[model samples]
Target chain A: MSHGLASRAGRISAQIGIVVAIFLFWEVAVQTGMANARVLPPPSLVLPRAVAMLGDPVVLYNLWITSAQVLLAFVLVAPIGIAIGLLLGESDYFGRAFKPFFFFLASVPKSVFLPVFILAFGIGFTQKVAFGMFQAIFVLVISAIAAAESVSSDFLKTARAYGASRRQLYLDIYLPAMLPVIVEGLRLGMIFNITGVLFAEMYVSRAGLGHLVSTWGMSFQMVNLFAGILLAAALSIAVNEALRWYENKVGAWRG
Target chain B: MSMRTAGGNDDRSGWILLLKNPLVLRLACLGMILAFWEIAPRMGWVSPVMLAPLSATVISGVTDFGVFARNLGVTFGSLALALLIALGGGGAVGLLLGSVRPLRTTLLPIMSSIYAVPLVVVYPVFTAWAGIGVESKVLFGGLYGFFPMLLATAAGVRTVDGGYMVAARSMGATRFQMIRHIMLPAALPSIMSGVRIGSAMTAIGVVVAEMMAATAGIGFLITQNRTMFNTAEVYFGVFLVVVLAGTIDWAVSVIERRAGSSYPRKVRTL
Candidate 1:
């Protein structure tokens, strides 16, 4: 047991070691003029720039815009996507019939439709939220349909046999049962939604993290650009960890 | 006989019983959805300026075939080249890593973490390195395709049944014989599924990269038309992408299904 733990610790350290090694190499390259600072900024430069930029109102607002779009996307799409899934998933006929629509939508890059979304909802926060939600809706609906279909008829029959109320039946039985798949779908939905919103902002928006990325590119501020990219990466990772925590929490709640 | 079995067990010849197939029936179900897209604008159920009539989009496509065809050809070229690089390089790396326990333990988690990041947003970095054109698109698409294929290949290799390996070893089976008779067939399904997902994502990544900034590509065409508010042309471009991406997805799905049928999955893969 001790040996196993040691090896596990060794493996983790190796992972960390590699990441540090890469950064160290980058810093050395920048210092030695082996790499162009104008094109790619090292961590030594980017971290300080990122810290300074965090105090700027525009940077903070852009960050908020990106985060809010992700939040709005999940808030708007989750229930609607699940509802649509339930509506269509209740019947096998409807499920098969609508499968093609889901397939086509899911396969296509939702970012390309950014213009359509901007036109429909305008270039404000609404457009970003709508675009993110649109991509997520397909993912959630597909998962929801699968979850609904997987609910055993025997359980429903037993509940009905016991004269369970409609709300109680769904709350006590269906919700708990399907939480895993639902959370999984939600995670997948959110990841793509985040990407979709970022892509939309980069393509056309006047403000947001993605826009900041473009702005930095135009001004040739490699330090700020690298920092922006890193910040976005950190945001994505944070969101991912949050969702995973929620999934585990749901599992515990059921237990 | 089941409707599927009656269709010949293989979908290719199975179409001889096409009328009896569930696949066809499901496709038939999509007709109304397609019709809604086509007729909604024409019938003024939606704004004509917003959504073009399907026929109008097609007419635009035909009329401006030169522009559409050129962009499409370039996009396809980039995608094809990207997939080829991904399959060859990623497949080898994933195979080696999966078969080696220490490597898998060290690398797989890092790959998984990187996978969740919005790699597409790093397009500026790629453009800076490779410049804004086919090279950048191909690289973006290739990286997108590479991760999935690698992860899948690793998962496939690791999940091979130990019992089979043990039996082969005991029987004095040579390494080549063991791989050919046992490893290849056993891991084929997971590898095929990886390829399936890789192809789909490659199409998406390439198109989106093109859309973001491009001198020539289908996505560029769509963007140009949209900027001018030429609704029909934009619609046509989107339609072409839908058809192209959908076709690639469908074709890969068929291959994955067939490749996976020979060996059932023992471990769940993402």
Candidate 2:
């Protein structure tokens, strides 16, 4: 146990050392003119600006807008995607007809339809939400179907034999068995949700994190651009970690 | 749903079989969508200004085939270049990390955290660095494809059987020979899967970068047409993108399948 703890400690220090080394390299390269400071600002500048952006009401508002759009899209996604997935999983004919379609849709970057959404919905909050929904639904539906399909037929049979009603069977048996995988899907879908909203914003938006970063880049505000990108990255990582934590907690029963 | 039951009687009649076949049903569904597309604008269900009829879209695609071909060449050329860089760099780094436990332990977590961040958000930074040209697009796509390959290669390396390593070491094989003959073959399936995902991601990165801001490419064509209210051209560009994406996915799946089939799946025996 002590040896394991020591190795983990070493690993943690190594991680920190590596991050510091990277920053040092960036600073040295910029200072030495080996790297263009204009394009690649040193961490010294970017980090401070990132911290400042955190306190900036304008930046906070943009972050909130992007987050709200993603959350709204996910809310719409869960029920509709789950219902469709359950239907596809339970009905053989539906599975045969739609599974491949959804699979194809999942692989194909649904962002190609951003222009259509922009044209139809206009470049506003609705457009971003709609785009996020389009991007996330296929991923959620596919996972939900897989989750449903993973439950054993024998389990369902036993539950029905026990006089479990349809709703009870779903609530008690199907849901518990499927929740872990569905949660996994939700985690993955959330990434797409973030991506979709950000992409729409980047392409065209009056206010959002994506717009801030893109606009900063265009105007050659290197520090702000890097900070915006870093902020976005931090947000994504945080959300990803939270979902992962939830997945582990919920899936503990699977062990 | 009721019509799906037509095959339950096992009548073996051609008409009933045709009606009941899953493939036919799938095709019929697609046909319905195409029919709807063809009729929706003309029937005034949706304004023609927003959506063009399927016939018009197809005609636009055919007439502007030269322009489409040129832009497609640009997109594919950049994708090819980007994939080459991603494979070389990511594969080398992955191999090194996979072979070294200390490095893997220290770096993998950091890399994955960075990976979780949608790299698309960083495209603007690339544009700032490399300009809104093929260079930035290539760089963006290359970065997008890099993580999948690296992670997969490392995961694959871990899966190499201990017996294989022991057998190689007992044969007095050099480290290079052992890696080339055993580790690489063992890792082929995982690497191929990575390639499948990486290629798709590379395409997405390039297309999205172009869509966001670009001088030329299929994605640019779609956006440019959208700006000009050339709805038919926009649809045509979208059609091409779908076809391009589908073709790449199909091609990679074939390669992955071939690689996967080379090694018999492991089965436990008492």
Candidate 3:
């Protein structure tokens, strides 16, 4: 047990070591004039700026709004995706009929629809939510369909032989079998939704992290822009890790 | 036996059986959608301008094909450059990491952290540095595509079955030979999937990079039209991107399927 713990510590130390080395190199390069500070600000400058921005209520509010948009979109699309996927998986006709359309929708560069969305819903949260939903739904549906199809035929047959009804077979055999795949789909959906929200904000928003990034970028406030970017990156990582943890917890049930 | 054969023929007539075949049903569904779209505008249920009919969109696409082609060429060029860099750099790093357990453990999280960062935010930095040109797009695409390929390659290498290495060693194979014959073939499927994903990432990178800064490419077209309120042209630009992305995705899928099928089935379960 101690040996295992030591190895874990050693692994973490190595990771930290790498990060330190990178920072040290950056600092040295900037200080020694080997690298231009204008192009790449040292961590010292960037980190302070990030901390200062954290105190701003507007930035926090924008972050909250963006997060809300992503979550709402996920909630809106996930159920429909699961339903459509199950329907398609259960019936080849349904799958065949809708699959191509889904593929086309998925293939479309969603950023292009910003104009239409703006036209229909105006430059409001509704439009952003719609874009996010559109971005996430296709991936979820596709993944769910694939997952549903992956359900073992033998398992379904056994359930049937035990006098299971259609509903019972679906509930007992299909749902459990497809849970992992559904979670995976959800992961992809979340990622796409996050990306969509950022893209939408960049394209048409009065305020958001993305807006802040662009605003600072145009002004050439390199330090503040880098700070905003770092914060956004941190938030993305946090959300992803949270989702990963949730997936693992849910996945444990399959055992 | 004759009665059983007759029963089988009757069973095959079920609607459920027909619906179970995706290819036929999917095509029919697409036809139905197109028919609906074509009819809806004519029936005045939807405005022609709001949702341009397929014919109009196609006509506009062809008429503007020269501009689209030039934009597509730039986008594809950047995508190709990105892929080359990603495959070359990612494969080399992944191989090194895979062979060195400590490095893999140390770098994997950092790599994922980089991947988790919304790349759009960083695009401005690249644009600011590289200016509004193809160089920025290539860099963006390379950055976006690299991590997936690296992770996939590393995972592929690590998962090379021990038995294969043992067999190769027993035959007096050198370390390089073992890697080439045993590890590479074992890792091919995963790496191919990575390449497929990387292709999409590269396309996305090009689009985002262009959006951030570019005078050409579909992204530039969309941005230009959007600002000008030329919704139709905006749609046209988007449609072109969609078509290009779809074509590339289809190509990748074909390659993956072919490569996957040709590889020994024994490697699959691994």
Candidate 4:
């Protein structure tokens, strides 16, 4: 390997070493009574319980629900958000009027919207789906609008000079231009999808991974709670990393 | 073209322009929404429980303004305090780690991964450790702000241009001089994005924690009304939160723009 590759390998190993050291310290602290076991359970205790719980029926069922919510939300948000984004990009008048509202909507406490959603959709699975969809939609819409706007005007002018039809201009030029940004929006939407679904579940739903985590928390089951949290984190990290990897592979065109 | 006056009063085009003004269009849209909100419940087309009529909501919001204002002040004050600490502390830590190569390689990945952990789930942890008070809410808000702020600051410092550094060094500049004259100026825009992001999240953290644990504050008020099925008051609380969030975002952006105006804009690349 070249010096660059070797240096990268060294850095990765050093990171792994630090993480292992921290876990070792944590286990020692709890086992030796240096830390309170009830409040801060060691990784050794938590890890086994976490692995066992992964096979539990309740854990599996709730995990399915959370994943389903995210999937459904992506299905809904991408089409509707992009359609509105296209409208905003094409019409300067509507864009001026609506973009600020969407901008403001983006910043607002989505938690406030949760109660409204729960009330409207009922305190059930649909409510969480609705919340998650809203959470992801604006991310898509805003990014889509910016992406569409950013298509080079010079390209449009050049196509027009060649007597290209409007349909041809959009299909051959703007659509391809918007692809990379839409992928980025897809990544953000997925992250927000998990977060929103989890938020709604944590607050009200009696089922799902979020509720399981909360149940553990309230019962003072520190080991179990940490395990559940770590499990959820692992899922999030998996999705985040997967999307990032895919983006890298497809986004070489961006070079 | 042959029939119309050239420059004098032409009410026809004036009406057309008035019709097309975005402000007018926006108001028209709001008016349509208000109209539907008022008519739907009374017409029995939609349940009032789901959406309280505009008039009833206005009355409830006005009558409850005192309560709302007090809660708003509490929530806003906690967020402001949390933001102050996060900006100062996170920025310092980010600068420190960002300046060191060994530390950055080891810790940056850990921090970024931790950032994706759904922090809202951990509200109960904060509640348990800190107890349900303004302090717990502030701490949670601080946590939210710190991660984004630090990441931005660190990335900003790390990405400072090598050419700029070389030019400064060739002029016999000291380390402090290089940082002040070159590093900070280049990093300002990225740091500004972090501040804006952190500021936006501050409201979310405070209000979510308050909703989960507090006895008072806007989130608590909404929950209280929600339990009673008082849709108007619930709507009122939600509106206030939206306003608070919007004000924070607008203020932060305005500040960022002012701070960054003198700097040359950096074109983002994929």
Candidate 5:
């Protein structure tokens, strides 16, 4: 057990060591004029700005806007997507007939539709949210269908033989069977949601973290740009890790 | 006695069978969507300006074929170059990491963490570095495609059966020969899936880069037309992109299937 813990610790240190080495290399490169500081600011400059930006109201507001759009899109799409998925999954004919279309849509790069959303909904909060919904719905639906369909037909048949009511079948069997996968779908959906919102905001937005990063980049404010990019990355990782944690919690019963 | 039905009954049942065909069902489903696309705008259910009719979009596509074809050539060129870079670099790195357990253990977590970061936010920085040209787009798209290929290839390599390696070694097979004949075939499905995803991402990155800031390409065409309120042309550009992406995805899957059948195991690859 101690040996296992030591190896894990060694692995983590190696990961951190690599990251630190990269940053240190960057810092030294910039100082020595080997790398252009204006285009690629060192972490020493970026890290402080990143920390300070957390207390900056403007930065905070942009973060909030992006987060709100993602949340709104997720909230609106999840129930409807799950319901459609369940129906399609439960019906073999409909599932086969419709799944191809769903897969095709999902495979398409949804960012290309940003302009269409802007045209239809205007370049405002609604447009960003709509784009997020567009990106997220397909992922959620596809995953939810997979989750629902994963429930064995034999289990359902056995339940029916035991005179289980429809309510009992759903409550006792389907929900428990599908919950972990559903949570996993939600996690993926949230990631897509973040990407969609960020893409839309970056493409053309008056306010948002994406816009802040873009603006900083355009003006050659490398420090601020680096900081903003780092901040966005941190937020995304936080959300992803949180969802992953929840996914593990829900899926623990499987083991 | 034969159990064959009468001619009239056979004809009716044949027709029913045709309707029941999976291909027919899929086509019918898509046909319905196309029908709605054509009818909705024409029937005033949706404004033509917001959603162009299918006919109008087709007409627009035909009329603007020169513009689209020229831009498409540019986008396709960049996509090809970006995909080449991504697959080459990612495959090499993945191979190294996968074969070396210590390296894989250290790096896989960091790779996933990086993947979680929506890499689009860094595009502007890429533009600043490479300029708003095909170079920037290629770089951005290459970066986008890199991760999936890396992760997938690594996973594929790691999952390779040890028995094959042991047998090859006992037979005095060289390291290079074993990897070439055994590992490559076994890992082909995963690598091909990586190609599939990588191509999609590369296309998206190139298009998004064009859309964000570019003078040419399919995405730029859509954005330019949208600003001018030429809704049909915008729809046409979008259709072209969807078609391009779909074709690439379909082609990769075909390649994957054909190559994967050589090894003949149901590897549930990503």
Candidate 6:
């Protein structure tokens, strides 16, 4: 086998070894009575509970609702962020005008606005979506604006000198330059989106993973609660990995 | 030359003119928002029950500020304790792990996964294990804050130029001396950034803990208000949280700027 293939194999083996070791240790801890299953439920118990939760329609419905809110919030944030960023990037006057206001809004803990949102939109998807959007939009806008700002002035000048139309300038110069940053903003936006949706669900939701966890907690179902948490972590990691793959693909094209 | 100088002066004046020109326009925008919010209810544009006018919310929030301040104190105290523990413990562990490549490779992933774990889920466990009080909140906050601190410090240590250490060794510097003089200084920026992020995380952890189960803190106030459907008080609690977060963020930025200035000229220039 080639050296690279051998190393890849070795790495996979190492990862498997680590996973096995962790489980072994955990199982041993439970069996030996070193760790209380009440507080820290062994993976044996937690895994089955998680699988059972997957079978539940209510759990699935909640997950769907939360995911839908996240997607909707991202849709709301991405376009506005790009538009504001483009405008801010294109004009020194606009940048100076809005920078401080953006900073102020960004620094405000978005959780504070949850009540305001619920008040305005009521305790439903609207409130959750608004909370998620508020959490994400500021970061996206700032990152996009920064990206836009970094587009070389020389490139713009050259485009203008070549009699390029404004539309062509934007399409050719700005979009290509800002795409990576916009992707990065989306990645961060997803984090905020997930957190916001979950928080909202926790605050006043009839269903969702947050609701599941809260319900399990209130009922002292430690195993189920642990299972829900593990699922959430797994979901977040999966989303993050997918984004990283996309980012790498985009970055390669940029390179 | 004199004409060109006069034109430069004109440019400066024009910039100042532009700066001063936006104040009224900005204030007008804010006024417009307030007016709309106020009149919309009166004009049936929105439900009065849903949103109290700005005046009423502000008055109620002010009246409730004493209780809010006490809760704020508890939250901030918990945050401070968490910060101290995370920085000290994480910094030490980071330094150790960073110096040993094998340890770093083996442990970094574990640290990161712990960091990424939806800490909110673990809140109940913490409450159960540590009891429902400030101690649980502190531990939860510290755990949330710890990962970033360790990651940042390790990153900082790794990024320190090998040349600096080599040169220091050639000059007969001890390991302790190198760490104190070289590593610490070089790592300050990353460490500060970690602390800043940690500060935010700590606040979130504390608030989440309090919301889950706690007797006192701004988060408890929010929870209490929410339960009572006292929307105004809920907003008031939120406003206090925003203020507290903003203050911590602003303070970190100021300190970072000052620290940045004190870095070596080459590093600062970079």
Quick one: best TM-score, which candidate?
Answer: 2
B1-270 per-residue lDDT for model 1 (tens digits): 143343555656644465455556666656766798798988889887778877887899999999999999999999999898677667888888887888898888777677778876688787777878899999988887888888898899898888888888999999888877777778898888888888877887888888888889999898888888888888788778878877887888887777767666554332
- How many collisions per candidate? 0, 0, 3, 0, 0, 0
Per-residue C-alpha lDDT of model 5 across residues B65-145, encoded as one tens digit per residue: 999999999999999999887888888887777767888888887887788889989998888898888999999999998
Across A1-255, the per-residue lDDT of candidate 4 in tens digits comes to 245988888888998998899999999999999988878889988899889988999899999998898888889888999888878877887897788877766666677788788668888888888899898888888888888887888888999999999899978778777877777788888888898899888888889988888787777777778888878888888888888777766566657
Model 5 chain B worst lDDT window (10 residues): B1-10
> lDDT for each of the candidates?
0.82, 0.86, 0.78, 0.83, 0.86, 0.77
- Identify the leading candidate in terms of DockQ: 2
Model 3 regions more than 4 Å off? A1-6, A100-116, A150-176, A253-255, B1-28, B36-49, B166-175, B253-270
- Model 4, position B238: C-alpha lDDT score: 89
Residue-wise C-alpha lDDT for candidate 4, range B1-270, written one tens digit per residue: 244233324556664566566766677788888899899988988888898888898899999889988988889888888898778778888887787878898889888877877788777677767778898889988888888999999999999867777877888999899877777778898888888888877778888878776878888888788878898898888888888887887888899888888766773332
Candidate 2 lDDT score relative to the true structure:
0.86
Model 6, span B1-270: residue lDDT tens: 122222223546764454454443455567888888667766778776566566666787889878888998999898889877777777888888776666666666566655545566667667767887899999988887788888888888888888888889999999999998888888888888887877777777788778767899988888887777676687667777877887888898999889878867465311
Which pairs clash in model 1? none
lDDT of 2 by residue, A66-164 (tens): 989999999998789888988898888778878898887888868888998877888899999989988889878998899988898898899899899
Query: Which regions of candidate 2 deviate over 4 angstroms?
Result: A1-6, A153-172, B1-25, B257-270
Candidate 6 regions with alpha-carbon error over 4 angstroms = A1-16, A154-172, A253-255, B1-20, B34-45, B97-99, B103-118, B170-172, B254-265, B268-270
Q: Estimate each model's TM-score.
A: 0.85, 0.91, 0.85, 0.88, 0.90, 0.86
lDDT of 1 at B236: 81
Question: Considering just chain B, what TM-score does every model have?
Answer: 0.79, 0.87, 0.79, 0.84, 0.84, 0.82
DockQ values of all predictions: 0.43, 0.66, 0.49, 0.60, 0.63, 0.43
